[model samples]
Each structure stands twice: as C-alpha cells, then as structure tokens.
Target: ETLTIKTASKTYPLYIGKGIRFQIQSFIQALEREFSSVLIITDSIVEPLYLKEIESSLTDFSNVYSYVVPAGEEAKSFSVFYDILTFALEKELDRKALVIALGGGVVGDLAGFVAATYMRGIAFIQMPTTLLAHDSSVGGKVAINHPLGKNMIGAFYQPEAVVYDIEMLSTLPEEQWRSGFAEVIKHALIWDKPFYDWLQAEIHTLADLRDEKLQFALAKGITVKAEVVAEDEKESGIRSYLNFGHTLAHAIEAGLGYGKMSHGDAVAIGMLFAIRVSEEYYGIDLELQKFRKWFRQFHYPEIPKHLDAASLLQLMKKDKKAQSGTIRMVLMKQIGEVETVKVEDELILSILEKELEEVQQ
Candidate 1:
C-alpha cells in the first residue's frame, strides 16, 4: 500500500508492503529523474544479508555503489557523514545520482543527510529494513548527532520516496522488536485511542506482532506521522506534537551515550514518564498500573538506577524543543489529545525524581 506525505516543499510517496525491494527499479523509473548512479547507504550488519538483492535490483538501471557504515546510532556521526561524502565524490556521484538509504534509522538519517548536502542536494529514496525506520524514514528530518545532544545537527530535507519492506523485519533481533513497537504504541497514544485500545487488548507479547497485525500497525503509525508532517512540515507548530516522548528520550540517549540503549527503549521510558507527569500536572485520567504492566510485559527498560534526574534535566535543556532557555515538551491532557507546553526545570526535576523513585521501587 502507499501513502502520500505532502510537505511545504514537495510531496513524496511512502510504500509499505512485503518484499517491495525487488520492485525498486520500477519505482525509481516511474519517478522519471534519470538517475545516473544509485548509491545504497547501508550498515555493516545489514550489508551481508540484503545488499546483494538490493544491488542486483538496481544494477540494470544505473551504476550501483554501496557504502556501509557501522550499525547503530554511532553511524549518525560527523566523521561517518564526511566519509560518505568522500565516497560519493570519489565515485563521481553528481546531481543526477540518487541515494538509496537501505537499512535502519541510523543508515537512513546518515545517508539522507549525506544526500541532502551532496552537490547542494540530490534525490534520495528510503528502503528501510528495520521496524524503527518506519518512523524515521517517513519524516524529512535527516540528522546527525552532536557531542552535546542527539539529532542536534541536521536538515529538513525530505526523501523522494520511502519503500519499506516488512519482510526485512523478520531477521531483526528480539531487542529490535521491542525497540520498534514503542513507536507504534506512541502513535496509538497520541492520535488514535481506538488503535491504542486495540493494541492494549490484542497485542500481549512479541509473538503477537505477526504479518497482518504488523502491517496494520506500521501503516497506521505512518499515516499518523504523514498527517502531522503534512500539517506542520518544519515543526513550527503541530509538528512538535510528534516529539511527545522524545524530549526525555533524547536526553536518555545522550546521557547514556548513543547506541548504548535502543531509541525505542528510551522512548518507552520517556512515554511512561510523560504519562505519569500528565496525570499529576494535568489531572488527566489514566490507568497507570495497567499501562505499567503492559510495558513490563513488553520488556521496556526501566529508568537506570544511576541516571541522575538533575543531570538529565540539564541535558533536556539542550534539547531542540527548548527555546530561550525554557524547555518545552509535548504533554498529553489525555489519550489522543496532546499539546506542547513549557515546563519549568523545577517541575521537570520533581517529576523525574518521582518517576525514578517509582522505577526503583
């Protein structure tokens, strides 16, 4: 199936299906761009497994090149970005060349950034292999991490198209399943209560994320993201709502060091915190224990015992959500209803301390 994401700059199609990678040549040909070269940017972990199939699919159409980066968040680095640029240059990739981001979120982000900056920008396609990339691939938010914060350096350059093949997810580790589902849950919580209820009632364990159900979840999540991005392409307003669990999530990733923890695990923890804070600060009605139980069953990580709430607050201040030294966050008044609010440091610290204490207990 296909969904169209309309942005201020341009519109692109997000294609989701089983084994769609095989049809990539036809898809690119339909774009009518006459790409001179196709650079497939993938990670080391995914290279040996899927590179041959993807490269073979494109070889008949254009000169195909592959650049493999280290797997995980570490790939979203300045050095790696520079290395990709060098590789593209050495191979003489020009404006007519197309970049194919052919792995998980890190590869997508790094490659998309490389494509966005190379030759002042070139067309790129997203062929996301992991479930987490379902969220990262759809948005035009390509970025690299800085020493100070996660996704601190980047651009709002959108992809030409996103071709997500669910078949690739079969090889993902159990941890990747847990990591990716958190975003699915996030989408449900912030936009569709019916979908949220469906998830809570139907999806009990990792085994439940099978073919039909998994497809439904991914399509719904992408639709939510597409609608939001269409409305606020640059995150000046409603787009901030997409960062519901991300403020604290980013802090946790940066605090623990990138790649040390999964992005979904951190966001799961952050979402739980956001839920608790919402109940306290807004008096929103929630079944906290029930939700907590669901999280535990799915193996979402609890807050680390040694992670200082004060330090995390300091890191949050550096988050992109912060404005003029005030930290802003997407807070829910209730399920399927949320708003961005300016949260004070003291209140944030108080809530973090409370949540951390509960985790310890």
Candidate 2:
C-alpha cells in the first residue's frame, strides 16, 4: 500500500508491504533527484540479515556504501553521530548524495539527522525494519539521545520517502512485536476509538500480530501520523498529541538507562500512567481497570523499583514538552481525545507514590 505524506517541508510517499525493500532501485528511480553516492546507515543486527538485499538493488549506483552501528538505542549518541559524519566525509559523500536508514527507529533517527546536517541537508529514505518503527519512521522528528534526556537534540527533517518492508519484521523476537505495537496502541488511544476497539477485538496473542492485522494497524497508525504531520509540521500544534504517552515514556527510558528497556515497553507503562493521571486530574472515568487488564495480558510491566518518583519527576521536567519548569503532558479526555496540560509536580509525585505503593503491595 502507498500513502502520501504531505508536510509543509515536502510531500513524500510511504510504501508499505512485504517486498518493497527489494524495490529500492525502482523507488529511487521515482524520485526527482539523482545522487552522486548512496550511503546506507544500518545497525549491526540488520547488516547480516538484509544489507545485501538493499545493496543488490542499488548495484547500478557505483558509489553505494553502508555503515553499521550498534544494534540498539545506544546507536543514537553524539559519538556515533560524529563517527558517521566522519565516515561520510571519508567516503566523499557530497551534498547531492543520498542516505538510506536501513533499520529501526535508532537507525532512522541517527541516519536522518546525519542526512539533515551533512553539508547542510541531503536526501534520505527511511527503511524501517522493526514494528515499533512504524510511528518513528513516519514522523520527521530525528535525534540522538542526551545523558540528560532521550531525543534531546533533534530536528524536524522529513525524508524523501519511507520504504517499509513488513517482511523484514519476521526476524524480530516476540518482545519486539509487543514493543512495537505500543505505538499502534497509542495511535488508537489518542486518535481513533474504532481502531482501538478493532485491536481489542482482533489481537489476543503476540502471534496475532504477524497476520494481516499488522498491516491494517500500521496503515491506520501511519495515516493518523501523516494527517497530523500534514496539518501541523514541526509540532507547533496538534502534533504534540502524538506524544500522548511520550513524556513519561522518555523519562522511563532515561531513568532505566537507554536500551535497557524497549521504547515500546516504556511507552506502555507511560500510557497507563497517563490514563491514571487523566482519571484523577479530569475527574472522569477512563476505564483504567479495563485498559490495565488489556496491557497486562500483553505483559506490559510496571514501573521499575529503582526509578524513584522524585528522580523521574526531575527527568520529566527535562522533557521537550515541559516549559518554564512546569511539566506539560498529553492527557486523555477520552479515547481518541486528548490535550496538553501543565500537570503540577505535587499531583504527579503523589500519583507516582500511590501507584508504586500499590504495585509493590
């Protein structure tokens, strides 16, 4: 399936299916610009699995090259970013060169950032391999992690196109599937109640994710993201709705240490906490227990013991959404409805303390 993402920066196509990765040459041919060289930025885990396929497709391009970073979130670091820039310089990749992000969100962010800043911006494509990447790959938000926070340094640079080969996801472990689906769930929670209900009715086991339902879910999630981006590029308005669970999710990732917990897992817990906060702050019934039951069935875990409320609160203050020392978060008014609100520190701390005590008991 093909979806056109119309952003103020550019209008691009997102090609989704089983074998689209093999059609890299055809997709590149469809682009208006030609490149002097092609640099593919991938991770170690994906190098052995699908690098040759992409390379084979680009045999017509004599200047094609590849760089392999570590397999996880650690790949999104300033050091790795610098190393990639050095590699690009050494290879003599010019401003007219193209970049291909050939892995998950980490690779996408790192490569996109490289393409964005390299010689003042070059064209790049997002070829996402993992399920979780569906959300990250669609949005142009690219960045590396900072010791202070996740995605702390980044830009709103759109890609030339997104080539999502769902077939490549077969190699992902069960946990990866669960992790990736968190974003899909988030999309449903904040934009489409029908999609949320569809998921609840259709998905019962992790294996269910491998079926046709996966494509439908991805398309729905990506479309939701595309429409939002088209309407509000650079996250100046409703774009922040996409960060529904991300405030606490980012904090969890940073608190636990990057790559220690999967982004999807952190997001799952973050969504739960957001719902809890919404219930209290809004004084409305969000059906929190039902949501908790669904999440637990998928084995989404609780907040780790070591990540204290005080420390997480401090970390959350560093979140991009936070402003003037006030922690602003996307809260649910209802499924498919949300708004950014400045949550008080005391309420957050109290909720954290109360929730942690319940979990421990």
Candidate 3:
C-alpha cells in the first residue's frame, strides 16, 4: 500500500509492504529518468543483514555506492555527517545523484542531511528498516546532533520517496519493537482515540505486534503523522502537537547520552510524565495506573532512579520547543486532544521530582 505525504514544499509517496526494497531499482528508474549515481547510506548493524539485498536490486543502475556508519545514535553527529559528505564527494557524486537512506532514524537523519546540504541539496529516498523509523522516514525533517541538543541542527528537506519494507522488521530485536511501539502509542494518544483503545485492548506483547497487526499499526501511525505534517509542515503551528512526548524525551536522550536509552523507550517515559503533568495542571483525567501497567507489559524500561530532576531540567532547557528560557511542552487535554503550553521551571521541577519519587516507590 502507499500513502502520500503532502508537505508545503512537495509531496512524496510512502510505499509500505513486504519485500518492497527488492523493487527499489525499478522505482528509482521510474522516478528519475537520468541520475548520475545512487548512494546507499546504511549502518554497521543493517549492512550485514540487508545491504547486499538492496545493492543487488540496484545492480542495473550504475554508479551505485554504499557507505556504512556505526549503528547507533552517535552516527548522527557532525563528524559522521562530514565523513558522509566527504565520501560522496570522493565518489564523484553530484546533484544528479540520489541518496538512499537504508536503515533506521539515525541513517535517515544523517543521510537526509547529507543530501540536503551536499552541493545545495539532491534527491534522496527513505528505505527505513525499523519500526521507530516509520515516523522519521516520512517527515521532511532531517538533522545531525550537536553536543547540547538532539536534532538541533537540521532542515525541512523531504525525500524523493519512502520505501518501507515491513519484511525487514522480521529481524528486529524485541528491544527495537519496544522502542518503535512507543511512537505508535504516541501517535495514537495525540490523534486516534479508537487506535489508542485498540492498542490497549489488543496488543499485550511483542508477539501480538507481528504480521498484519504490525502493518496496520505502522500505517495508522504514519497516516496520523502525514495528516499533521500536511496541516503544519514546518512546526510553526499544530505540528508541534506531534511532539507530544518528545520535549522530555529528547532531554532524557541527551542527558543520559545519546544511544544510552532507545528514543522510543525514553519517549514512553516522557509520555507518562506528560500525562501526569496534564492531570496535575490541565485537569485532564488519564488513568496513570492502567497506563503504567500497560507500559510495563511492553517492557519499556523504568525511568532511571539516579537521574536528578535538576539535571534533566537543565537538559530540557536546550529542547527545540523551549522559548526564552521557558519550556513549552505538549500536554494532552484528553486522549486525541493536545496543546502546547509554557510551563514554569519550578512547577516542572516539582512534577519531575514527584514522578521520580513515585517511580521509586
């Protein structure tokens, strides 16, 4: 199946199915009649497993080269970004070339940035292999990491297409599923009440998420994201709602060090905190106990007991949603309803401390 993501700048097809990566060569050939080269940027973990299959599919296309970066959040760094640019230049890639981001969010973000800035931008494709990537691959936002913040350096450069082969997910570890499902939950919470109820009732374990169930959830999540992006592409308005749990999520990732915690896992914790804050300040009624129980069933790691509220707050100040020293968090008025609000530092600190204390208890 295919979904079209309509952004302010352009529209692109997100193709979802089994074994779709094998058809990428024909898709690329059909999309661009004449291209100079095709660069397949992947990661170490994915390279051994699926790179050769993708490379084989592109054998008919000439000047196809592969570049592999380390398989983790660290790959989304200035050094790696520069290295990819250098490699592309050394391989004689130009504006006519196409960049294929062939892994999860890290590869997508890094390679998309390389494509966006390399010689004033070029065409690129998203070949996402992970569940978490279902969100990142479709959105036009691309970036590399800075020391202080996550996704701090980036651009709104959409891809030529997104080829999501769900077959590739068969090899994903359980931890990866845990990581990806958090976004699925986030998507449901922010947009689809029915989906949220369905997930809560039907999905109880990793095994429950396989096959048709997994595909439906991914597509539903992607559809929610696409609709939001269509309405507000550059995050100047309603698009911020898509970041429902990301403000604290990004802080946790940066505070613990990138890759120390999976993005989805951190976001799961952040969602709980957002819900709690909503209950406390916005007078929203969310069943904290039931949500925590559901989260535990999914094996989302507990928020670390050692993380201090003050330190996390310091990191949160660097969040993209922050404005003039105040943090703007996306809080839910109800499931499927959310808004961004400017939260005071002390109240945030108080909530953080109370939440951590509860988790400890």
Candidate 4:
C-alpha cells in the first residue's frame, strides 16, 4: 500500500509492503530527476544485511557508493555526521547527488540532516529497515541528539520518497518491534479513538502482528502522521500533538544516555506517565491499568531508579516545546483529544517523584 505525505514544504510517497525495498530502482526512476552520484548512508548492522543489494539496485542509475556508521543511537552524532559529509565531499557529491538512508531512525535522522545541510540541500530517499522508522522516516523531522536534549540539532526537510519494505522488519529483534509500536500507540492516542480501540481489542502480543494486521496498523499510524504533517508542516501548532509522549521520551533517552534504551521503550513509559498526569490533572479515565498490563505483555522496561526526577525535569525544561524555562507537555483530555499545557514544575516534579517511586516497586 502507498500513502502520500503532502506537507507545505514538499510532497512525498510512502511505499509500504513486502519487498518494497528491492524495488528502489523503479521508485528512483519515477523521481524523474537525475543524480550525478548516489550515497547510501547506513548503519554497521544494516550495511552487511542490505547495502550491497540496494547498491546493486542503483548501479545502472549512477555511481553508487556506500558509507556505514556505527549502528544505534550514537550514529546520530556530530562526529559521524561530519565524517559522512567528508565522505560525500571526497566523492565529489554535488547538488545533483542523491542520498539514501538505508537504516532505522538513527540513520534516517543523521542522513536526512546531512542531506538537509549538505551544500545547502540535496535529494534523498528513506529506506527504513526497522519498524521504528515507520514514524521517523515518513515525517521528514530529522536530526541528531545533543548532550542536553534529543533531536536538538535538526531540520524539517522532506524526503524524495520512503520505501518501507515489511520484509526488512523480519530480521529485527523483538525489542525493536516493541520499540516501534510505541509511536504507533502514540498516533492512536493523540487522534483516532477508533484506531486506539482497535489496538486495545485486537493486538495482544508481538506475535499477533502479521500479514494484513501488521500492515494495517503500520499504514494507519502513518496515515495519522501524514495528515498531521500536512496540517502543520513546521510544528508551529497541532504537529506538536505528534509529540504526545515524546517530551518525556526524549528526556529519558537523553537522561539514560542514547542507545542505553530504545526510543520506543522510552516512549511507552512516557505515554504511561502522560496518561497518569492526564488522569490526575484533567480528571479523565485513560485506562491506565489496561495500558500497564498491555505494556507488560510486551515487556517494556521501566524508568531507571537512578534517573533523578530533578535531572529529568531539567532536561525536559530544555525541550524545544519549552518556553522561557517552562515545561509544556502534550496531555490527553481524552483518547483522540489532546492539548498542550504549560505544566508547573512543582506539579511535574511531584508527578515525576510519584512515577519514579512506583517504577522502583
């Protein structure tokens, strides 16, 4: 199946299904643009698995070259970003050059940022090899992490197209599957009450994601994201809804150090925390126990006891959504309805303390 992301910045296609990655040639041809050279930026883990195959598919199109960064969150680092740029320069890649991000979120963000800044800009495609990339790859919100915060350095650049071959997800470990579904859950929670209900009713375990059901969930999640991006391309308004769980999620990732915990796992905890905060602050029932049970079935890790609430609060204050040292969080008024609130640090700290104490138990 295919979904088109129409943002004010650019419009692109998201091709989702089995074996879509192998069909890169046709998609590249459909672009109707010629590239002087092509750089396939991937992670070390994906390099051996899919690089040669993607390179072979693009051989007839241009001088296909490959650069592999260390896999995982660290790949989205300034050093690695600079190295890839150096590689691109040494290879004489120009404005006509095309970049292919051939891995998960880290590679997509790093490569997309490189394309966004490389010589002012260049064309790129996202060939997401992991399930988590389903959300990160489609939206064009690409960036590297900062020591202070996650995705502090980035851009809202769109891709030429995104090829998410479901078959590529076959090799992902169970943890990756757990990680990717967090964003899918976020998409449902922030909008589409029906979709949220569907997930609660039908999806019970990782093993249940198969055939059309997996594709349906993925396409559904992507559709929500596409529509949101279309409405607010630069995140000046409703697009922040997409960050429903991300405020705490990013803080956790940065607090624990990136790569220590998967993005999706962090988000699962963040969503749970948001649900609790919503319940107490907004006086709404978000089925907190139901979500907790479901998360347990998938084995999401808990927030580390060592991550002090004060430190996390400081990190969150540095979030892009923050204003004048105040914390703004996306809170659910109800499932499918959300709003951004400038939560007081005292309230936030109290909730964090309670949540952290509960996590310890």
Q: Which candidate is the best by lDDT?
A: 2
Question: In what order do the candidates fall by lDDT, top score first?
Answer: 2, 3, 4, 1
Which segments of candidate 4 are over 4 A away from where they belong? 146-149
TM-score between model 1 and native: 0.95
Distance from true position, residue 269, model 4, in Å? 0.9
lDDT of 2 at 244: 89
lDDT of 4 by residue, 161-271 (tens): 999898888889999999998888899999889998999888989878887888999999999999988999888899999889888888998888777898899999899
Clashing pairs in 3: none
On a 0 to 1 TM-score scale, where does candidate 4 land against the true structure?
0.94
- Model 2 residue runs over 4 Å out of place are none
lDDT of 1 by residue, 42-161 (tens): 999999999999988874655889999998788999999999899899999889999999999889988999989999999999999988888899879999988766688999999999
Model 4 residue 56 lDDT score: 82
**lDDT of predicted model 3:** 0.90
State the lDDT of candidate 2 residue by residue for 1-361, as single tens digits.
9999999989999999988898999999999687899999999999999999999999669999999999987889999999999999999899999999999999999999999999999999999999989988987999998876668888999999999999999999888998999999999999899999998888877778764788889999999888888899988889999998888888988888777888889999899999999999999999999888877778887888777899999999988789989999999999999999999999999998887888787
In candidate 1, list every pair of residues with a backbone clash: none
**Which residue segments of model 3 deviate by more than 4 Å?**
none
Please report, as a residue range, the 10-residue window in candidate 1 with the lowest summed lDDT.
Answer: 55-64
